[model samples]
Target: DQQVKQNSPSLSVQEGRISILNCDYTNSMFDYFLWYKKYPAEGPTFLISISSIKDKNEDGRFTVFLNKSAKHLSLHIVPSQPGDSAVYFCAASAFAGNTPLVFGKGTRLSVIA
Candidate 1:
C-alpha cells in the first residue's frame, strides 16, 4: 500500500523555537522522500528532500532525516516563525519523472508570536 503517514494533524510552537514533524511510510518501494509546505488553496512547494541512499539532508532552516530501516522520517524547522504557519505534507516517490507522488493528509503548523 502506497501510504505515507503523517499522524499529527496540527502543531503549535512559539516563535524562535524549533518545530518538528514526523512521518512514516508503509511502502518499502519508496526511495525518495520530500517535505512540502502549503498555504491555503495553494500548491505545495518543494522544501527539502533526502534520497534513500542518504540518511539526512539539510537546507537552510529545514532539515529532513530518513531512517529506511524503520520506514520513518522527520522534518525539523529551526527558529520557527509566524510565516511558517501552514500545512506541511509528507510525500514519497518511488521513481522520478512521470510517476505519481503519494502524499499524506498533512500537518498544520502554527507558530505563535
Candidate 2:
C-alpha cells in the first residue's frame, strides 16, 4: 500500500493564477513534509517544506501547509509561471532529515502562458 498519494495526476493553471497541489498520507507518524519540483529528465528539486510543529511555511511564491489531524498537506504557488510547469512530488518521513521518505507519484502541473 502507498503511504503517500497525490490524488490528482495532473493540474493546469493559467499564467499568473494560483496553483494548488494536494497530498494525503496514511501514516500518522509522518511529521515532516517536503515538496519537490522536477522538470522532464532533471532531478526533483527541493521546493518548500513544513514541520508538524508548524501549520504553514512560506518561501517566496511557494508555501506549504500541514494539517496533522487530517493527515493532509498542500503546496501553493502564486502567480504561476510557465517555468513553474513541472511534476511536483510530496514526500514525508516520520523523522526529520535522518530517515527515508515516502513519495507520492506526483502531480504534473502545467502553467499555460
Q: What are the lDDT figures for the candidates, one per model?
A: 0.92, 0.94
Which digits, one per residue and each the tens of the lDDT, describe model 2 over residues 6-86? 999999999999999999999888888999999998999999989899999999999998889899999999989999999
How does model 2 fare in lDDT?
A: 0.94
RMSD of each: 1.4, 0.7
Candidate 2: minimum summed lDDT over ten consecutive residues — where?
Answer: 93-102
lDDT of 1 by residue, 1-113 (tens): 53999999999999999999999999888898889999999989889888999998999989999999999999999989999999999999886423578999899999999
Query: TM-scores of the models, in the given order?
Result: 0.94, 0.97
Best by TM-score: 2
Task: Write out the backbone clash pairs for model 1.
Answer: none
Model 1 TM-score is: 0.94
Off by over 4 Å in 2: none
Clashing pairs in 2: none
True lDDT of residue 108, candidate 2: 98
